[model samples]
Target chain A: MKNFEQRLQRLEYLADRIKEPDLPIEEAMKVFEEGMTLSKGLRKELESLQGKVEMITNGPDDQGGPDMVPFQEVKE
Target chain B: MHLKKPHVDAIVIAMGFPAKEKAAADSSPLLTVSELTSLIKGNLEASFPDVTVEGEISNAKLASSGHFYFSLKDENSIIQAVMFKSKLAALGFAPSDGLRVRAHGAISVYAQRGQYQLIVQSLRKAGTGDILAMLEERKRLLASQGYFDAERKKALPRFPGRVAIVTSPTGAAIHDILNVLGRRNSAIDIVILPAPVQGAEAAPAIAKRIEQANRLDIADVIVVCRGGGSLEDLLPFSETVVVKAIAASRIPVISAVGHEIDWALSDFAADLRAPTPSAAAELVAESREVLLRELDQFQAVLESTMRSKLDALGASLEVFSPELVKARFEILSLPIVNRLDDAHEALVNSIKGLLADLDHWIALACSIIETASPQAVLKRGFSIVRRVGKTQAVSASAGQAAASRGGNEIVRSSTGLEPGEHLHISFAEGSALADVREVNE
Candidate 1:
């Protein structure tokens, strides 16, 4: 998600730069291409629908990572 | 001392009338005032050893010793109560005047004041009104400490990787949060810090779990949540421990306690307050659809910006096309070209006029030359005369004929001729060679 946000921000910046009246054509073209690439990548990521629903039931690992497992709903 | 019966009887008979008769009539022993008071105190203490009394508190004061002295009163009756400093320190809420409470204590007699009062060991707000008052007091205190200051509130992470929920494992709050999160964004890692959402142990357990979550430093945000319940059921959320924990947390806290209408102190102290547990989950992670929409909008904007830039470039390229440039150049240079043409025409006309003037002058010069010509003068019957010698030497020379042909000098007047000088005269049609026979002046 953080990566996505950063990419989106970069895309926005590129878009803004492309709008500059005096920007060199070569630089504008490069920025526009980069913006397109980031936009496509973000869109693909959003479309992939990749995620996990994990629950941390124990303390963090020695490396300070969560000890997570797939969450199972307990029905009452 | 051994003759006490006779002496006492004698003293009593002297001091009061019918002492024996009164004692016999009452069928009881006579007791002093201090002894009777002590007997009553023992009886009262024994009767109400550990009683729980409910009433509104009045005249509540916290003495310098930290003990709380108050009167518990109902509609018609009131009882003096005292909660020692030690017990008062353990209380979750402040005891104040007019707050209804249930106090558990032992009834003891104040022998000095001759009054019976309750020695309270524990105290609790008895109803919603008193609970609200206690919560209000706590809110005021925490507020003064800047616990709920907007400046102190941490902003929630826009995208939280991990979210720790401090809620009951078996309550509806957990299930609702999980469901909402699962539906919206399953990417978030959930840590369930299970604690009782109700009852006496709930507040501390919740606070401990919040602290543990912070200690671990794993979650980007913490959510303290509970499902809808009555005010009494939601009291734990309003507890000072829980509120303080929420206030002091480094990680941003989202409080979603009870229903939308139920307000808890945790709600005020937390960085954000959600109306429901599900709402908190939603706040933690944006839905995939929403993110997709945002991405699409961004892409559209980026593409449009690039397209407009390309269009502008195309427009400039069109403006600079070769044919268009030539046409514009011509248009821009039209006045200068016209001026040059006019200048060229004027120059040609002036030159022609100058040549014509030169032609007239040449004609006048040619006529003057024809009139001044020697042939024309000769044709007018005039004769040319010349002396065939050097003026510096008057004598005839041997090369005279040669000098006559090559170096003859013309005489402007007869007086200029010398006597005996050889002369050559030429008419327009013929020539003559002669000698000056006489002196002429």
Candidate 2:
């Protein structure tokens, strides 16, 4: 799936181009509506993130040795 | 306290350079003890002047006056050295026992103590071949291969949706990177490729992670980081494997190792070098945060832009309305209306002038009428005459005056009336019948 960054970049680009001084008010309104819609949708998607930090585990011989190392914060 | 030995007083005058028994008084040109001491001091100073000697230091101490006193010695020989406060302050590194260094100064004698010493001017580390040089050499060798070339450095994506952190799982670097990523934006997918960042395995492990991230295409960028440590601990970051791995990464690699002073070879090879692990996380996450901020700004711009457009439309709409046309018509007609008022006032004044002229003409006409009217003659006792029954034009011939239709007409001339003809005569006050009029002739 195309990531949110690309979508967000496209939305930002449309928003920028819509601000041209010479653009007709009618056309500007149309673009503004699209940008606002995209922003709302993208923000909603970002807020509803479901994935957490998933440790990749190997199957079969799940010895669980030092294969996948869990992150630790060294205070130094 | 160690006891001072008395063997020095026991003599050695026989063993001294003079050899008193062999040299007769006239043959040796007998010299005083002070003269002998001065001669020895001058010869020693001249012979060993401006010499550079390398030795390990011992009994190093700094006095209250900031002078450094130490003994420079090797296995067999020992020399007392003193560096005054000025030169000691200029020494970049600290001095202590067991540190080997080269001391450069003139060998001079302290006449008061009667002891010879090295007045050390400058001291430097005796580093003919050490880690500092080894590291530099490795860096130079790698750099020659364009491993650290600016052209080889890849530009990081402006908004990386996926990131892989290549660092010790047991290190603060991973936590810092994840914390920064989560705080700025959790939308990015983080793949923590755990690896050692210290010890012998650190270099190879870090290299493996970078290769894995590239092969799997698991991330848009890779971050290699470790906490601050001594040069010995951070050595892995400078290893050829780590440096070469960073240089060969398909995805941009960011190296953040140790504190401000610690620069790993990986730093030079990576796309960007951050001074600290936390700083590296901040640097990599900065673009996404910037994007978010810019998105908010553009949203505001979009709103304001739409609002202004609507406002402008409303303003332009008002221009074409009936009320505006009416208002404009009133404004446009103002000067014409004012001009007409002025003209009306001028017309009234001119009419008044014409009326005044008419009043003068009327007086003249009234005087002429007064002169022609018979009322003035009547007042002067004059009488008017008319034919009794003529209303038609008065007969010019006197003979036809009797044949006229019956209407009163005045006899205009005396020739129209005979002396015996009946005629109506009227004074200004009354009428009478009588008429004897004779032609004046």
Candidate 3:
């Protein structure tokens, strides 16, 4: 998640840089390509995200850490 | 004690039973206190086996054994009531002094005290009005401590990697949250920290689960939620423990208790108050479609900006291209080229005039030379003569003969000429040999 946010920030920055009036064409093109790649990767990641549901067990493990297991909804 | 005797008779009369008449005392056998008390206890227990009484509670106390002891009172009367630990545990809200409640229980006589009391099996707030007033007082107290201060609230993470929900495992809230979160963003991992969402035990259990979620530190945010319920059913969410737990959480909390109209103290203490469990999930998880759309917008902006930049660059390049440069260069160098062309024409004309003058001079010189040259004179029928015989010296022939052949010299005059000397003569077209008879100077 942190990486995703960072990537998004970087992409936005690139987009902003590309819009700078005085930027050289070569530099602008480089930034534009980077922005395009970052956006593509972010889109793919968002599309591929799979959700998972789990429940914390009633008691902690021997190490006093939480134990999680897939949650099954009991149907009435 | 005398006042209670008539009240006891009134209660027995209300139950459609005749009281033991003190007037029949002379004819009847004297009854012991235990016997009489046992009889009253049996009668009371049987008559009011299952009853619900609405009154204000006073002197409420929870014992160490978890029994709740209180008195239910109306404007004119009061009755002692005790809810054992088991039944007390099932209460939706805490029983407190000054709180009005409807107590459901059986009435039994305490023989030791020679009085009858209610054994409450369950309890609920008498009405919403008193509960709201109590809630208002609690809210003020908690507010004074800054439990609902905005400054203390932490901002929720934009993209939560994991969300731990503190709610009932079996409640509709859990299902709604899961459905909404899953539909919006499947990437978020959910961890259910199960707790009873109602009853007297709910408050502590919820607080404990929230604390436990913090201890685990596995989720980016904690969502405390429950489906809509009656005011009493949602009382636990307004409990001090639950509100304090939400305020104390290190992780940001989102409170989504009951429906949109239901407001719990937890909502105030939490970082964000969602109208419903589904809304809480929506707040915590970013929708994939919305994110993708935003990305698309960024991409479009990037593409369009780059296109225009390239187009502008291309336009500038066209200005510098050969054709355009040539056109501009022509405009700049036109005068210089015209001046060079004029200079070249003038130079060619002057050289031609100089060559003509030289040609004229050469022709004139040729005519002058023709007038003075020996060859030109010879062409005019002049003849010259030279001696062909041997002659060693002939100074007199200097002007007459230009060349000597063999031993012969030309005789300018007849001086030094011998009678036997042969002479060679030449005219413009012919030459002849002859003997000279005379040489006169």
Q: Which ten residues in a row have the lowest lDDT in candidate 1 chain B?
A: B390-399
- Model 3 chain B: weakest 10-residue lDDT segment is B392-401
The DockQ values of the predictions, listed in order, are 0.32, 0.21, 0.49
Per-residue lDDT tens digits for candidate 3, residues B196-295, read 9999989999998888888878788899999988788899999999999999999999999988877899999999999999898877776455667889
TM-score of chain B of 2: 0.47
lDDT of 2 by residue, B1-441 (tens): 112122322232422554544343334444566765676677778878899999999999999888999999999999999999999888766667777889999998777677889999999867633877899999999999999999998888876666777777667777777777678665666667777788887788878778777776767888888887666778999999889888889999989997766778999999999988888777766766676676778788889988887888899899978989998988999899999999999999999999999998899899999988988888789876666532333333342343233355666676655555556655778556654555553
Which ten-residue region of model 2 chain B has the weakest summed lDDT?
B1-10
What TM-score would chain A of each candidate receive against the reference chain A? 0.79, 0.65, 0.80
Q: Which CAPRI quality tier does the interface of model 1 achieve? A: acceptable
Please give each candidate's TM-score: 0.59, 0.52, 0.60
Off by over 4 Å in 3: A58-65, B1-126, B182-187, B284-286, B364-441
Candidate 1 lDDT, B160-276, residue by residue in tens: 666888888778998998888767755667878778899999999888878777877868889999998767889899888998899889999999997666789999999999998
Better of 1 and 2 by TM-score: 1
